[model samples]
Target: MSSTTETVVIGAGAAGLMAGIWAARAGQKVVVLESTAQAGKKILISGGGRCNLLPSVADISDFYSGSSDNAIKRLFRTWPLEQVQMFFEYEVDVPLQLEGETGKLFPQAQKSIVVRDALQNELLNLGGEIRFNHKVTDVKKVGGDFVLACGDNVISAKKLIMATGGKSVPNTGSDGFGYEIARRLGHSNLPNYPALVPLATNESLLTDLRGISLRVEWRAEKNGKTLELGNNDLLFTHHGFSGPAILDASHWIVRDKADLIINFTQVSSEEWRQRFIDEPAKTAHAVLSDIVPARLAKALLEKANVKHDDRVGNLPAEKRKAFIDVICNYKLAISGNRGLAVAEVTGGGIPLDEVNLSTLESKKTSGLYLCGEILDVIGRIGGYNFYWAFVSARLAGESTK
Candidate 1:
């Protein structure tokens, strides 16, 4: 015999939990099935465990989606950030504190476990049952009911919310299984890729400059067109670049096979050239060091084949031009990304158009809905991803109720 429920939400991650909570609140018998023994595994590791739960601001322009921008706006507008904050503070009993510097909102306790536990407790208190270790292997819609197969046991629900997340961070239990279920249930998935992951570079200069961090103007260029210009702090990792700037711009790099051009000095080539000419007698290293780190100044000179103590006025015309270009428009040889294993979020999933804008119900299958990273919405470094999860899941759960 199969156990049945009013609502069955697959994967008890951020989206899954939120959906379960809302569904239970609406008097539905909800069972949130999690593959792993623990809930919110990804949440446990987010923001280094502090858990950046929401972004300070969630502009539709801040998110990337294959769906229309207006569609994205409507979804976000459904549950604004203010209401989300209130829900965490009052309903979940977890006060949120915003980090002024990053515009990321964390629990006042500054703990990821706190946020996870609070949500789980709220759901349980509201009569929602979370069956951990009950990994639903397959789902099928028969008439108006959805039948979910979790190994030998079968659980059926009038409404099924697919919050299994995307392929990124597979260890967190989202192994792209949600897409498979969606495909089998009659939905098209977009090309999936790792988003918010660090870019890999084999540039010897960048390798040597590991640990050197600075504010850079990072640009993604493909063919002759420039895609995005992200201005943020960029950190040089042992392998490549990993920071807010790189991670935020990574989707563009991965999607378009784009080239990365960084303005290390945050100045244009003409401005840097003019500065060099103005300080004709000053050594290039001396003038550049004031603007950039001393180590980078020395490395740039070496890369340009100019002596560290070479005066700007004494440098050959070609050498001076080369040095300016190196500093102002440095191109990184991006070999590849760190892949989905270490990615913060997955880039692609089911197209948003496939789901109803207001309710997030599947257009192809009745009583089916999709939310979270399972949809092709990629948010930037802050808490925009979580913002999407909370908002979308809330709508799905409420709509089912």
Candidate 2:
């Protein structure tokens, strides 16, 4: 193996592999160092093995949530959606299809291995070398170039790109090692936290409602005001609620006092209460199983002290109103999130302001680039994060070329 190359890409993930492919295609000698026995472990598991390649949405603003809007804006503008799609379609030989309402792109065959194989094949075709089981322990700047020490071998390169992902999914080989490397290279890290994880609740109701799922609208409330509203599949677990809607809201709810109010009713409590009182005989004994799952309905009724056999016609007005209140707005106190183990992505990393947006090179370190989840840029669910990985790595590779 050549000890030195024009460019060295670390991590061999989506971003690192893409960078190696692009830089090598541009005629720069490139080498990729991966700690694991094989690369693309995360990619293999993403989208439940289908691999959401990219989002079909053209607008980039909908993806990110950090304070650095300008940085994100510039990064997307450099490598926009259309260009990202074309790269996979033509260069990588992976045809993509839009899966759902959010425009998430998956392989036409819905196999993640296809995407990983395609990218790796393209990189190899362009003469890129990937060193597997090479875990980089330390990175140092010696004079003008970067020297990486991995398992007794010191590899030097003209430029070093850190595409090591964040602390999420440590078993996949991302354990925030890149953050230590960045700090050693004079980059300041923002406080890292788990994002896109499940929320845990201290409430007793959730214990009985575990395994129950409902289509409901949930809103995050703080200091007597609603912070955000989301509508999607909500699930009850032994700890608390999870699913797309609950997980998405966990970011904002992390700092709160573990208290969140959920609206389980299809309509407002006041409206439902009025209707129930007006037609108690017709609705009071109505089984909630039709509106919600049988188990969930039983739990809700039990919570409201309403017997399953009690006729709506026999129910008192006050009791009917109380049932409506519990059904419409059931308050549950969230204890915490599930942490990095179950998180799909992390929230913070290398701050955007510390890196040059056009190049993805650290403002503090010359000849060093940071990409992927290692940087602070994180996206919501769907294929936004994958897009960011591709675009950011493309900019870094092109700049180094």
Query: Which stretches of model 1 miss by more than 4 angstroms?
Result: 1-3
Clashing pairs for predicted structure model 2, backbone only: 258-334, 284-312, 285-312
User: lDDT values of the candidates?
Assistant: 0.89, 0.82
Candidate 2 TM-score, C-alpha based: 0.91
> What stretches of model 2 exceed 4 Å from their correct place?
1-3, 58-61, 255-259, 270-274, 284-287, 307-322
Superpose all Cα atoms of candidate 1 onto the true structure and report the RMSD in Å to 1 decimal: 1.5
Q: Summarize candidate 1's per-residue lDDT along 252-317 as a digit string, tens digits.
A: 889878888888888888886777778789987887888898888888888888888889988888
lDDT for position 23 in model 1: 84
lDDT of 2 by residue, 205-296 (tens): 66678988877877778777887677777889888888877776776677344345666757777677666667666543363666787777
